[model samples]
Target: MKKNSLILSVLLVGITACSTVTIKPEGQNKLVNKPTYQDSKPFYLWGLSGEHRVDVLKVCNKNEPLQMQSQQTFSDGVLALITLGIYAPHTVKVWCPKEES
Candidate 1:
């Protein structure tokens, strides 16, 4: 039991220590329907760290909604990646949603 408890504690600590991300609403906020296709949705900026991704739907001004829209949540990250011109803040990021598959 002691060995198991120690391992579990270490695992939890490692999981908690990850990068965090920030998001901003670019241009205008658009409404989107989530996993369900037939309901109201909210304008949102999805914040992801590393290579994480999510699908978002948005309706154009005079057209129906579009799906699988991609937006950049890491402007500073890209700069940091190319060189050391900019520094991306290190933060722990945890997505609250679960994967469907």
Candidate 2:
């Protein structure tokens, strides 16, 4: 019983620690229903350290990012919970337009 409560509390904290957002550029007449380019990587050590490979031109095949969407996964949440905020990971997704020639 006590363990369950502790785990639940840990999970909540882990999830709340991460940031998530979905936003589009303003004043752009064109609107995309979904993100054509996306990327995700693991954040470690309470997000103090992680590998981020979301380079717009190289990875997303775009000149600049137009919008971004991000969310934390359940497995990541569980891992963070078990680790008690020592090992929380996060994922990020990006949307961008093609590079101008």
Query: What's the CA error at residue 45 for candidate 1, in Å?
Result: 17
TM-score per candidate, in order?
A: 0.21, 0.55
* lDDT tens digits, residue span 1-101, model 2: 99999998886875665556665678755444666665456667766786665565565564567776666666667777678658776666666675557
lDDT of 2: 0.66
**Could you list the CA RMSD of all candidates, in the order they appear?**
14.0, 4.8
Model 1 regions lying over 4 Å from their true place: 18-101
Model 2: clashing residue pairs?
Answer: none
Compared with the true structure, all predictions reach lDDT values of 0.35, 0.66
79 in model 1: Cα distance from truth in Å? 27
Model 2 CA lDDT for position 42:
64
Q: What's the distance in Å from true for residue 26, model 2?
A: 2.6
